[model samples]
Target: MSLRGKIGAGAIALASTPLILFLGTWEGTGQNIVYGDKLARGLPTVCKGLTEHTSPYPLVIGDFWSDARCAEVESLVIRKGQLALADCLTNQQIGQNTFDALSSHAHNVGTSNTCASRAVGLINAGHLAEGCKALAWAPNGTTPVWAYVTDAAGQKHFVPGLHSRRRAEARLCIQ
Candidate 1:
């Protein structure tokens, strides 16, 4: 039977390892230092893309966190994302790689958007591989989504970094 509701402990544990590594690779550790997100136009962000909104505390410029502290916060954030993701997922018995990829995508985007995403909808409809591909492209299969950054001028620009990350997640999802 397809599992639903909250993600089980075993699945969480299995996905956590690769999810963490994947996040570190894409988000970067930021050397445990807070910096402004250029895409967000000076929004302060810390290790592994932790912003004031997501961080336990309000992030300020130049704030520093130890590596251990960064890891702790990253774990907390990922756990929260996983929980929210579980609520949206109709089938919780997905593979570890797929879970990790979805969790990573949810971490980058918000859980709400991830939940309402075409990828999730496709996954729920049992189109597993298609759902994975939807991470990089829209339903039309050519238009890129989640691969843009808003600038200070309120204009959106395509970001190669985001495209690369999404493609990586899609690859992991299908593995």
Candidate 2:
């Protein structure tokens, strides 16, 4: 099925195959183990980036999740993120690629922030390409915004992995 078809079916089915694959590629399937997120130190994350915020229960170090469990949680998380983002999007006619890119961004950042981002505002204003570019850079187009991670001391620093991911997301959005 095409990505659009999958997305339509995802409304009832929870998650689409392509969306799952895209998130898995970025989030990484850390199967059977729970580990602290270096970026958000002390937070236990597992199974494709499920943290206590996204999980039904608290996650601790040494926690384990079977492959099936991981798949289930990942799908749930993706679906939830998609639904939350959908509420913020005024343009219902957006293409599948744009939707996927926005959903992926919402999954990584929070839906609240993604909804309020300049990218979404630009997209709503019908500036599709500019919106895509805004995913990585600020409106000025030079300074990076979403590519940084905040440390416990409240210092934000550039994260290479996040920068690469945002670039990939922008590419997907413009495609």
Model 1 misses residue 93 by how many Å?
3.9
lDDT of each: 0.81, 0.81
- The local distance difference test score of model 1 is 0.81
TM-scores, each model vs. reference: 0.91, 0.88
The root-mean-square deviation over C-alpha atoms between each candidate and the true structure, in angstroms, is 1.9, 3.4
Candidate 2 lDDT trough over 10 residues, lowest sum: 3-12
User: What is candidate 2's lDDT per residue for 1-175, written digit by digit as tens?
Assistant: 4333445675323365666787788889655688888887777888877888888767889988889988877777888887777777776557778888888888888889999999999998889999999999888888876999888889989998898889888998999
Error of 2 at 67 (Å): 0.8
Q: Residue 158's C-alpha lDDT in candidate 2?
A: 96
Which RMSD does model 2 reach against the true structure? 3.4
- For model 2, which pairs clash? none
Instruction: Tell me the tens digit of each residue's lDDT in model 1 across 75-137.
Output: 887777777687778864577788889888988888899889999899888889999999999
